[model samples]
Target: MKLNERSVAHYATSDSPADHTGFLRLWGGLGTPPTAGGAGRRCWFVLKGNLLFSFESPEGRAPLSLVVLEGCTVELAEAPVPEEFAFAIRFDAPGVRPYLLAADGPAAQEAWVKVLSRASFSYMRLVVRELESQLRDARQSLALHRRSPWKAGATGRSKPQASEHSSRLENGHSPSKDCSPGGSVEGRGSRLSGWASAEWELPGPASLLLGRGQSPVSPETSCFSTLHDWYGQEILELRRRWLQRAQGGRPARENKDRP
Candidate 1:
């Protein structure tokens, strides 16, 4: 395949971090079979991302060869010269001869094999996609957690307001009439006091345990606890009114009846 020599030359000389770099013995010409009795040449090999570049020396600005480490496998191979630590990069393409290379030692051979095996664009893309999926799931979990308190507060407040309105209707009073000027000041004050009491009592353990500045929902005070407190307050108010009637004291209805 024809490569853009200018781009390849720029990348070869770029200061970008390399994945692996070392001097290795390269056998034969690029894509050609090994010669009958010729020894391999030791060249400076640099692996930057998926592109492998070989230079005449470590400081060489020009690259002698370029190998795209895609659709390829790196495996241990027996070199022509015995005692040489060798490996071959075999590509999947037809009529493409494998690139035979020998490292200086066993450690270098193993390291080159490991790095080359993972140096494909496909492998890097897979890693990126996995990380993105994990990030998305984390964001979703955080959004749900943030909305939980507001949802619970809305549900808790709605139930109490509905029950309060129903109780007023059963007692022969209109919600609109509660705001009228004809109502006694004492009655209005008492109603306001009840509302204040309920409002104060709504936060329950959140206020007591976490202090006034803390949020209304705490670990100790969940939606269940808030609903329980509201219902409990209603029961207490009903019992108090019943006791006042039994004692023959003036009930709140008498205030509306008076001039």
Candidate 2:
């Protein structure tokens, strides 16, 4: 957790490993070819909470790199593992190459997978919650805009005209008449309320980011593209629906199938 900076001498001479109080340490190789020098160099991995950190040795005194296990996709290696990699699991980190980690054995591999899965779920939930909160704020803003007095009108003026019902209320119209005072406001309110209640029923942009058919092993890079596309479409659809309702209290026929 400290992540203190250390000099070369400090790294070479010091061997102060973390207590790993709530950490699970697994011995594994970083990778090969690019990391050939560290290959077979028996590194110590400590997974604490949602983060996984590696050390040069088991004590975890020599800090290597740390990875936040959020937005990462995991999958079994499509290619067969070589003899050296009898227990291997692949992870596709965002904006990075697909790195292969060779676990010590089957037990280690399973443990790593379990921890990573939990981390991924936690991360996803956090992202989705944040997105939902943002969406709620956006809906509130849209409602405010709809209720603005400066909304467009045929009178060529920003100030909106009082509805007949509102004028009736102000002039103390007889309640016995067929048209009740404030009827227009009440009817519009009811319609808007119904629409507001249905807002939550629609799938949010974040929920649609990862398609229903997306594989657990799908690359994060591709998922981003899908998410952007889905998000854009959802925004456009929402704007179009809002415009129609504001214009004539009905959805546009062109986008009838969208919602």
Candidate 3:
């Protein structure tokens, strides 16, 4: 494949931080068969984000070879000389011979293997996607935490009104008396008692099912069964109250006896 040799040369000389740079012994000249008996030539290798370049010397401005680290695997290999810390970059393409290289020591050999193995565009993309997902989740959690205080403040504001109504009921006063038309005091008291019994007598089963501080299921869930059951309970409670009023029985006496 044709490469932009001028751009490659410029990048080799650029001040960008190299992923890894060191002297590694090359087993053969680029595009040549390996020699069996010769000690390999040591060259300066620079790895820059999936591109491995070889230079004649550390100060060389030109790149002797460029190996694109894609569709390839780095594996520990036996070198021509015994005890040489050797590794090879083996490509999957047909008729392409593996590039044999030897690091100066065992530590360097392992480091080179690790860096080369991970030096692929696909691997970098995978890591980026994983990080993005984690960041999105973190942002969602922060938003929920931020909204919690506003919900608490709203609940706090409503409490005083509820307390005032409850105190009026306890003091034998009707909460709706101010707006209600004038009538006999006994008649007004009975009407207020009946109104409170129907409206505020029992807490809904949905609130009981969800304990304090727990949010109710969202309407957007499309959970029709739960919604039906909740409303069914409410219908049953209203029906029972209607039957009591029809029979001329007052539930106020029963409610007043409760703790």
Candidate 4:
């Protein structure tokens, strides 16, 4: 392929549009570097076994290429330029930065393990705690309001004490809709409604962004195989818990609330 003095074109956009992400397969082989030369020019490193890595663009884009660094771990689809991409190249590329350095094998491995473990445990605790607390609160509310707090089954379906300036205009007691996560409610009539409504509200925005801010910048690279087994097991546990939650918190149809 030939650049033929045609400069590489670059598009500047904040978020990538999903459909246009497959621009790498456009090349059959290495094209000439987009840069002519110098301190921050583009160049091609190597291409073999369907691994077409570039040194000028973000795998296959423009506007941010002193040198595009692209590589495909998986061949058929487009290669992924990881978030640590530029950092990896700057250290490994020899010329990107004079003072940059790569760590030894063991150090790099330890760094990656530390980062992945932190993420796994953080998410594990967050998700587990949320579900556990919600279940506890709902159960407690039911226990408290099982029949009637002040009286026995002799009252049958009685309401809690009422007031003229009460939050519950329709019912004789305050509404349990706003009890939130673990706040117990007491009243037989709205017990089911309280739990259903709370669960409905709980799961939607209960998100926990595991690794916030920027991506990990250890400057050291290591293959993830060492932590893969533990990561995989934890992921399976999270998935199983999520599935159970989905079944448990399924929304009720208004029409089906009859019985």
User: Best-fitting candidate, measured by TM-score?
Assistant: 3
Q: Residues 33-117, candidate 2, lDDT per residue (tens digit)?
A: 4333334444566655555566666564555756555545443332233433222223444446544455544455544544454
- lDDT to native, each model: 0.61, 0.40, 0.61, 0.28
Error of 4 at 198 (Å): 25
Query: On a 0 to 100 scale, what is the lDDT of residue 27 in model 1?
Result: 92
**lDDT (Cα, tens digit) per residue for candidate 3, span 1-259:** 7778898889978999899999998886367466667568889999999899999999997988899887676667878998788888877678888888999987888778767766765445334433433443464365456543233223433454345434324432222332121222231112222221211223422223233543333232126685466446545655775576588794675445433
Give the TM-score of each candidate: 0.55, 0.34, 0.56, 0.17
Model 1, 1-259: lDDT tens digits are 6778998789788998888999999896495457566458889999998889999999998998898877676667878988888778876689888898999988888778767766765445334433433443464365456533233223434454455344323432221232132322231112222211211233422123235454322222235676477457545655665576578894575435443
Q: Candidate 2 lDDT (Cα, whole model)?
A: 0.40
Model 2 spans with C-alpha error above 4 angstroms: 1-40, 78-81, 84-95, 121-259
Candidate 1 TM-score, C-alpha based = 0.55
The residue ranges of model 4 lying beyond 4 angstroms of the native Cα positions read 1-119, 148-259
lDDT per residue (tens digit) for residues 1-259 in model 4: 5542223332222342321111121111223332323122233322221122234445544332222222101101111222111112111333333111122233332232222222222223334444434443454466466442222321322232122113123211112223222333222112212222222233322121223332221111122563365235445654664575567762354224322
Model 2, position 157, has a per-residue lDDT of 16
Clashing residue pairs in candidate 1, if any? none
Query: Which residues of candidate 3, in runs, are more than 4 Å off?
Result: 148-259
